[model samples]
Target: MLEEKKFFIHEDWVVVILAALIIALAVGGLILPVPEFNWSNASELFQTVLEPRNLGIIALQFTFVFIIAAIGALLNKRPLKGYLISFPIVYLITIAALILAGNSQVKAINLEAVIFSLGLGLIISNFFKLPEWLKSALSTEMFVKIGLVLLGTGIIFADILKAGSLGLIQALIVVITVWYFAYWLCKKLKIDDELTMMISSAVSICGVSAAIATSGAIKGDSKKLSYVISMVLITAIPMMIFMPLIAKYLGLSQEVTGAWLGGSIDTTGAVVASGSLVGEEALKISTIVKFSQNVLLGLAAFAISVFWTYTKHPNSKDPDSKPTIGVIWDRFPKFVLGFIAASLLFSFILDPATVSSVKSSLKNLQGLWFALAFTSIGLETNFADLFSKQSKKPFYAFLLAQTFNVVVTLAVALLLFN
Candidate 1:
């Protein structure tokens, strides 16, 4: 019986399998069409977004992902009955958020669907009492890892190579420098290691996405992850609006401004929106810089996993005790392997034509998974815990790190792009 129990699949392994299976289906041409949600006005919204055909597409998407969620629940040895009942409600809520995000006015401000998803979930979870079964069924980590694995397909190495050498250089310097800076600040502030890592990654890397990835890699708490994510999203808005004004005021060139904005801002959408406020040249350069930074996400996750397992694992308390390779491997997040594999397959193995055909469908699924994860995160998190007295130090550390990020990135951009 002990031996049999040993064979019970870990959630991480199940995520890898499920992600790979989804990728296989996408590559095999079982592509689902992305529904049109963009609308400028209420009338247009009704005519285009709420059209019967579009509604059907949305329903189909829900059905596909629901099946995938159920399969994941089954493989993880969780109770499927509760998940089956709760997932549809989650899906509906996420859809409402998606529609709001898809509105033209929301797009103008560069708000993401996940933000609304998080907000709605928070509203529901905070105001009402939830059942234990519903809470139990919220598989936030699994959903995040699967979305991240699917996110890999978009991180084509070929595109990264073609982006710009300078962009890659800036990304490397900024991520490493800002990460350590944030970490050191958190340490000085007496923040816990988990919050420190999540905050550092969110500030230095790519905001919500980076925080989510780091949380999954380290198996951090959802409440802490939610806190970091909230900080990222909230700070991003002001940064997005003000950075361009500051750049213009400094008499910076579009190239320098673009690089600065790209490196400093957390989210891709925010980066793009901020850059566009500068000029077309700025828009292009900023995107290249952001994309370059995004490509490093996989490598960072791997390094963090190795470092965390080697130094922070329960068995690694003794300084002289070296963790064996097998132990490290056992501790690694297998979904990261799936993430890298998906990237490689899309980058080198698949033909461009095939990639183009399925890219939209896969991207949609990826966003949906991320949205679902954030919703779960919001549901699982308590309002007071998310912003408790204990969070002040981490919050201060993040702001200080972000301020440093902005100044340093501007200097780098001036040096490299000016």
Candidate 2:
């Protein structure tokens, strides 16, 4: 007899279910009185976990982990026993990293939880051997997609509008210019198309999320994805801490400095950290500029999907076959649609107070999911392959592109905000 298909539920359905659950929870939090979750004491994981107020938050996290692990077990055609055994291990490790990241000194320097989580996971995976069952449930992409969908709830269009036309103009200029320049530089460096696309997207857009979305669109290698993520995270820290200092040294106004940090820094968290280092007004401007760039993520992913599908398919037998709308749709990353929908629903449908309340509760959960995903990336990646000869070109190209991005964005910020 033929072996039964391992998974009853399709992967696409898992995406849909997870996205719906996150959106539903956000909405529910608005109507219900949900306890606020804070990461301020993340360094004291044990103490924080024991606190009565954090009990609900911990339960919520475990619920998500259990759900995803169960679904992943089904998809891999594995026994749920392994998943149950492994998820807590991964979670505990992630929690420890978060705790370290939450230390006052670490937070002051902008060492984000995601970075620590990924680093700790890498150390464990490299220095010690892990059980196969534990590795099986890592599910890096799945966790990331879910996190991105939840992240959508935080992006409000009203805030984008409030950012004003100058912010939009600055964002557009930085994104388009940096994107093509990075793409061309990667091409010149002789990196492959998929890797180049991912690097460019990460540099030009929202860093890890942009890279993940591009990888999903083009069906890129997980190793390459991990490499790109590593680069983004490693570079983001110094930039986050020093950008504001540099702006201050130059005597740039808070608004101009905020716009520069927002447009230049690859990660949103880093942007916020850098912006805050400047002042309240700088933080506000930086957030607006970053959000304006963030709003373009879905569109950029869609455009890249169409371009890659039509221009770069190596197996296409017919040289002249025109790509139809259906082909583009098929190649598109479905999670992006969910991401956009969540943003729109939260931004347009909910009243301001409800949105604010929902965001406060849901934001930390989103960070947790992303932390888990980055940890998974570390677990699944081999250090040797990540630092291979083939990876060098892309790394240098990314560095050059990011340098160009900083200079250009600073110029644009001055032109627009100064």
Candidate 3:
């Protein structure tokens, strides 16, 4: 039994590499190698900005990944079997519902999310226990890092900067308040330090995605990752539904409120959904705010890691036992690379036509790749066991962080914008 289990883990590297190659190939096919196309300024209605046609293109491309993940989970019964199966299954269920309902764009985006989750789920479920050699080659940590690197390729920091001084200030204030408060609350609630940090960071930063990347970077507990994700998903839908309504009641400009909510919310997918409820400008602003928050991820991780080292281990010299300055660099998630790269390419080039095509391509690949990573995360961690713990600390931390973010961001946006 021991030998069999050992071999199982060793086999994971094969899955990791296979998963990466497929994702990379898809990206190359869609956006990496493609040339930009340009179109001059033209006034268009807000509804027209998110072309349903473009979303459809994304969905069609990602369906294969979802199917593989969902089907593979049904066939496996090893560790983390629930999320391993749920990742793909959820995608199929959600995307199929959208497709059947004739919401083509949503169907497409969901398709991308699903496929991305599926690939990751399969890899994490079965391979996490493989040989040290295989584990070394393509662990979840490696994939998340690589994903960050690839993400850099898709962002244009300059373009984000164009949103101006207010955007930067709002993002900075909101992220700082939320992250700090969440940490305090979690500690008060007596949650383990690692889990507390992750939940707080996820809520105050860019939501589930940010939480996942940061968790991977710091080698956080697996159970901690699941809790953060669960909170994000649970809070996301209700927030998405009510936030726009709240904005309307407050007489807040759609753009302002959307930006506030997007930056403050705990998940990117939900942010996009919430923004669409308002208008195109709101949608655009919200995404930028959210992205700006995302831009700070690398810096934030490093800062937090420094804090953890001094606080978590005052005297321990063992590098792995406590935070090491080197760990931040070694563990710095790589998806930031991909995000930064894309941003720079777009900012400098700014060729509308080619840029759009490339952006779309990268978005699709990012979505799919993320889905795979999600699957891996879900499969490796046991959700049932976690729920049983009733981690009051994490919950308290998330609530406090989100509350602080809302208060601080709103105050700033009002003072600055008004």
All candidates: TM-score: 0.96, 0.91, 0.68
4-62 in candidate 2: lDDT tens per residue?
87536545446657767766866775332332323455555445644776667666667
> In candidate 3, which residue ranges exceed 4 Å CA deviation?
1-143, 314-328, 331-342, 349-354
- Higher-ranked by TM-score: 1 or 2: 1
Model 1: how far residue 260 lies from native, Å: 0.9
Ranking by lDDT: 1, 2, 3
Cα lDDT tens digits, model 1, 7-87, are 578888899989888888888878999999899998999999999999999999988889988899988888999998999
Cα displacement (angstroms), candidate 2, residue 343, comes to 0.7
Q: Report how far residue 29 has shifted in candidate 2, in Å.
A: 5.0
Candidate order by TM-score, decreasing, is 1, 2, 3
What is residue 4's positional error in candidate 2, in angstroms? Answer: 12
Candidate 2's C-alpha lDDT? 0.82
| TM-score of decoy 1 | 0.96
